[model samples]
Target: MLYPATKVTLIAEHFLVERVCALIEACGGHGYTLTPVGGKGLHHLHATSDRATLVEGFDHQQVEVITTDRAKAERIAERALKELFTNHSGVVYLESIEVCRRERF
Candidate 1:
């Protein structure tokens, strides 16, 4: 049987990664995957298709959390948005997903 769940993804500057992870755990997220990522966003100083023209050293991190329910997922996203994104460069969103082994999550 498939178990319903929510995937919360947060992409933010590397500096705020630890704080965000702490918030996720506090909000009942069992675990998450953190990865180094790079991209251009609406707030970017230069949003261009030319990869070569992209600025250097603008490090970012992608945090993904799969929760057993939507409530927990929303809680995490909302807290991050209100507390962290006020003066930070980041994005948080949610996606509905199914897990084969719910216990693992």
Candidate 2:
């Protein structure tokens, strides 16, 4: 069986995980997976510079969604950018993927 899949990767401040998931669902993605991340970026410094200890835990969260169609992935990216990108520290990217199972997506 051939599977159609698109990987949507979102890197944003930890607090927006739920909101980004909601945007993914709203754009017709069935589900997603999230992993905690720690990195440096322009926003990371400006926001956490004052808290020396807590800054170590101040990491971005990444959400990945596999969708069955390319359009769905594009929609998810667009909606996320509009709804959450502004005034937030993050980036969203989409990549084409091929898989063996059709139902999983």
Top candidate on TM-score is 1
lDDT of each: 0.84, 0.80
lDDT of 2 by residue, 66-86 (tens): 987898888888888888887
Query: Pairing residues by index, what is the TM-score of model 2?
Result: 0.82
Q: Stretches of candidate 1 above 4 Å error?
A: 42-50, 53-58
Off by over 4 Å in 2: 42-58
lDDT of 1: 0.84
After TM-score superposition, what is the CA distance of residue 100 in candidate 2 from its true location, in Å? 2.5
For residues 1-105, what per-residue lDDT tens digits would candidate 1 score against the true structure? 899988999998887899999999898789999887777772354457866544554478899999887888899999999998877878888999899889877
lDDT score of residue 73 within candidate 1: 88
